[model samples]
Target: MRNRKNIAVKILAVLAFLVFLIINSRSISNPFRTGISGAASLPLKGLNGAMRAVKKIIPFASLREENRLLRERIDLLNRRIEESGTLSAENRRLKDILGFKNAIPFSSIPAEVIGRDPSNWSNSLIINKGSAHGINDNRAVISMKGLVGRTLEVGRTSSKILLITDPNSKAGVIIQRNRQGGILVGRPDGSCKMIYIALDSDVAPGDRVITAGFGSVFPKGILIGEVAAVGKEPGRLYKYAIVRPAQDMTKLEEVLCIR
Candidate 1:
């Protein structure tokens, strides 16, 4: 502290300042005090004015520089917040799939939906795992709730999913109560129907529908939907049942592909 004080004292010159203070010591509230103060600050004011004149050519020097730095910081923080939220959501989804994975019997792989076809958003989506992970065409894709879709195309690192909500989707399903079988097909407005049930069958509303394991696609006994309505196709002998699929296909994020 002594050394720093000595250095500070040595760097300051008090000759003129001492003279002004001595002259003002006996003058209380005098105009000379203000005049002397203004006179003493003339050099500093001139220097500041000169710097501002130079800054006029430079166009916003210190303030613009500080604002630029602040903007950069804000952008970086926004990106970090976005990345953090995304990671948290992904972590939660992985945990859910981990729990579901433990309860299933078939060999399966978990994947994320990374892309979608806007023209057919509800019908198809792209997953992050593919042929490299043993995913192939016609492999069933399921969510924690129930069936999600089936793999329609596969790549080395990604695959396309054909959601059962698509109009082209078809799977053999059976009414859980009485084992009445039919094909589940999608519609334009994104609903499904179980076709080919006999009109005389004992099917009713609220009966569960499940996969029949009849085709090479989905395996047997997965809850597909609950029967919402039962009716006959006009002039057709076999009836059709409106089925509400268990999975909310519009909001899929992660799914499992069964091998």
Candidate 2:
């Protein structure tokens, strides 16, 4: 009896498998078999869904890489633009200096500033052109704005400029307002103190000051600075005032040596 039961169960299992195969074969052959095809391809549908997910991730990865490359390109372009602008500005400044050099009545030698005094109060610089370039002591140096200084010492290939703000330096200057004349003397700090003006002189703020050409060091009509402030202390014979320098010594780069 047990052997007969086991043979019946095996026959049932074989029949069930045969029915499944027949249904799938019919679905494959007939286009109208919708429900049967869906049931048969459940596992394949899951694999298709996984493939679609991978396809979506591909676009996202590609987009991220494109963004990174674009950022790098933008950075490169910005650097190039900055370099071009700097070159253009430098060329303009050099052109202006060349034009000024040509217009000057006195012959001049061009010099590049090589070094600067470490102390802010020193107001002096070293130039690459010196005695070899025909630069001599007491020769004036100038820039686009106006007079800078005079060559204090010269070497074979280098020279030192004694800035107008040196304490030991003095220049004869006149006020452009009323032609009131005074001497501009440097203080320990980097400012010139105007002295020898009459107590009743009419010098006011914002008046332009220029080299008077009396001392014969700096040429006449060279701009020095503007009158910043004026004051009269008790028992003082002359009015004293401070003058701001026209050229900024901190930004000195190129200067002309007046022969």
Q: lDDT per residue, candidate 1, 95-119, as tens digits?
A: 8899888888888999876655568
Most accurate candidate by lDDT: 2
- Off by more than 4 A, model 1: 1-92, 120-122
Q: Kindly report which residue pairs in candidate 1 clash with one another.
A: none
Every candidate's lDDT:
0.77, 0.78
Tens digit per residue, CA lDDT, model 2, 152-229: 756656667888888867889899878899999876677788998899899988999998988656888888889899
TM-scores, one per candidate: 0.64, 0.70
How well does candidate 1 match the true structure, expressed as C-alpha RMSD? 33.2
Compute the lDDT of residue 249 as modeled in candidate 2.
Answer: 74
